[model samples]
Target: MQKIDIRTVDVIQYLQPLREGGSLPAIVKADDGFLYVLKFRGAGQGKMALIAEFMGGELARAIGLKVPELVFMNLDESFSKTQPDEEIQDLLKFSVGLNLGLHFLSSAITFDPLVTTVDGLTASKIVLLDSLISNIDRTDKNTNLLYWNKELWVIDNGASFYFHHNWPNWTEHLTRTFPLIKDHVLLKKADQLTEAAVEIKRLLTEDIIRDIVSSIPEDWLQSESETMSPADMKAAYMEYMTTKLSNIDLLVKEAADAR
Candidate 1:
């Protein structure tokens, strides 16, 4: 089994807020002297969003897609107290523990499907990955994709795997065809679904899924359920993903039919 480990960095300074999203993620300088887009744990959608972001980004990387590096960011209580803005300070105060961050892409531009064209294989892989993870944010209006360094980079996966929000019936979602995949921004360009499936299956194995689920911090899973422990939450995620992998053909068919 391949062990997946995420680097932990202490946030040194909160630069500014990226106000586009509801979470109010900020660009912060980490102890490593690098700037990262930090996702607050206390934001709307809570730590579940961070877990989704972490798992989704790592899975995208595993499937040969370009994703910004993800790291575990530590936000100190004292650091939150120094912020001048009331709203920002409140957000930081609630997010004092561990949060998630992505490496800041210097000059990345939002991917405009109308202006920029993507190849069939790349589009198919992205579509399939999004469908597998149940990501609803990658639509025409909000393509959570970036064009940087002459390549397409995936980002902001906080909306994936939403079944966790209603844990009582997570299994019901495992077999879903994800009909919303029709709205995927890359659906029209994804003509190579079969080829993408073959490659993705080869790369994403059961062991890899297990490693990704295990990497989620226990603190994030604590508030999920009183009856279900963190370990139980991890197990649920593992089951959800493994079941989704086994039923990948359902998602592929859905995408193909949508196209």
Candidate 2:
């Protein structure tokens, strides 16, 4: 909090009757500047939800996508709402906590999902990205996508990240393969799933991976350790990345053909 950049911000406020159930509270700056969607530590989904949004959203931005602007802040615990999911709420009712700054789209002005933002090709790219990252979110209907500023903004990555280690444990982990690239947008002349695979292949690095893992807040580490154990999750993630890199050619061709 030394030198400032986004100085135009006013006071951050919360809205009522928030749309989503678990994540309702938002850090809304005055005069429609921005809103930060803070993730809470409920019973079922631990801090992994926060990690997924922060890391995945950052990765998407790094890969040249129009993701919602996010900021990592140590906001007051009052900013987030406790889970109403009876099971989760019951378990964590004793240990109320603050939040992990991974704000979502609260703006009403964002683009329409069909008209302005992404199409098949972009979706396919997202699918490829998810597969490589072992992301269990992104579905045809659920948490699939969002459109803003004529470009799609990706969100709801809780199913990925630290949640991977809980794979056998998380009963809701999605296991569907993706569609072909030709069927996707293809971007007319820019359709190059093959090249993209190769590119995605090259982008992987130990540093990038390390940066991702290290970015997760330490307090988010579970006390029980059985849920989303970082070590196990890290190994699984390593294996997942390796497999994706190895099969880059195959996946790209597969996507292209399916399209």
Candidate 3:
């Protein structure tokens, strides 16, 4: 499998904190002269959330979905020294290493399901993607979707693959039906789930899965396992995803039934 290439940038400035979620992700300017929304490794679920975000975003892009460009953002301890708020300073102090960043969509608007009309195929594909990744945050209350340039963009996938939080028996979740599909924001419009399944299976090949899983930073996997090395963790992720892909039909049926 060809290795995936993700760019790494150093954060030069902390712009502001986006206080919407518990994670307290912030907008920061990187050395590359661009602004990005940085997900801190020190916050909420820590590096595991970044791992899930990377996997979810890359998988979505592999299947022809619009996701903001993901980058490895390096944070320095000095950035925290002059911070006014104790909470923000403490967050930066702890996150003084590699964190995940997404390219900022300057004029993007939050997707409001009440006013937005998504087509059947698009909605079905989104539903399938969420089901495969086991993302539970895309409800009407916290739709993580954005509208930019008249197109839908997926964002904040840190909530995907939540099984990693309790890593003892992660395999048991591979073929389990995603009951949370009933709460997905797009479930009502997902009429072309069968078609979406076929397309996802075609696009999200083993090579793609391997490439994405391999791209996960070793630091993120370090504290997650005591017996398993980072390499072992990567292999486990590959296995989980491949098993999930093979059982896509079960996910499709569950999603269709939920609607």
Candidate 4:
């Protein structure tokens, strides 16, 4: 991720209350003079989102796009420990208190169903990666694209692989899901393609990914596997992750030639 412009952030002091959802999500002020999207280990299994988030955001940053500043916080459990209704607790499985900093940009960048050209390259890269990861969350409605410093940024990668735990057909290639691959004009720019490739290479070799994903804590993943064996989940992760890494190389090769 690009370092935050000093002018945009100062002392991250207090947190402002925002809308509530899976794990009492909030917007927090950061020391760098920016606001961060904060997720607390609230009443549900929200913490699992952090795993996807850190992994996705890290890969995205290595690819040379602008992603929000990320900090793995050790939150004071006192402030965020209020449990939700018992029935609600019984209903969900997620952790809370994951805070992600924002750029506090000057314009509005909506996840509009219509594709725009200004940041199309970055958006295309993100869409392509999401497809590889089976990220079912970045649909037309909640695609977390942002506008900062007159550039496009990708955000909110929490719901990826939500259904992969017991997915019967885990080996299916994910590239088939993207609807705008042909429409994004910026795909021609290919600015961050090589960078993305480097990052993908680093991640596939990292032992942490293999160690952590097995305990993927999403409610669906945790609950669905009790009736069946866990081998398919592992198989699916290997299948798509390898596909994503290979495409990263392909995109990087395209970028090297384009420039």
Most lDDT-accurate candidate: 1
Model 2: lDDT of residue 18: 35
Cα lDDT of model 3 by residue, 1-57, tens digit: 556689999999899999986889899999999999999999978998999999999
TM-score, one value per model: 0.97, 0.65, 0.97, 0.55
Candidate 1: C-alpha lDDT = 0.92
Clashing pairs in 2: 37-103, 120-184, 120-185, 121-184, 121-185, 180-259, 181-255, 182-259, 183-259
Compute the lDDT of residue 163 as modeled in candidate 1: 94
* Model 4 stretches with alpha carbons more than 4 Å out: 1-14, 20-23, 30-34, 43-45, 80-108, 111-116, 163-240, 247-259
Model 2 poorest ten-residue lDDT run: 1-10
Show model 1 residue runs off by greater than 4 Å.
Answer: none
Compose the digit string of candidate 1's lDDT tens values, residues 1-259. Answer: 5567799999998899999978899999999999999999989999999999999999999999999999999999986778888988899999999999999999999999999889999999999999999999999999999999889999999999999988888888977878999999999999999999999999999889988998999899997245778898899999988888888898899999999
The sequence of per-residue lDDT tens digits that candidate 4 reaches over residues 229-251 is 44545555655665556666554
Which digits, one per residue and each the tens of the lDDT, describe model 2 over residues 83-181?
Answer: 455543443342245344434565534334345544544655675676555565554335445664445777656665543545664323223233323
Candidate 3: the clashing residue pairs are none
lDDT of each model, Cα atoms only? 0.92, 0.51, 0.92, 0.49
Name the 10 consecutive residues with the lowest summed lDDT in model 4. Answer: 1-10
Candidate 3 TM-score over all chains jointly: 0.97
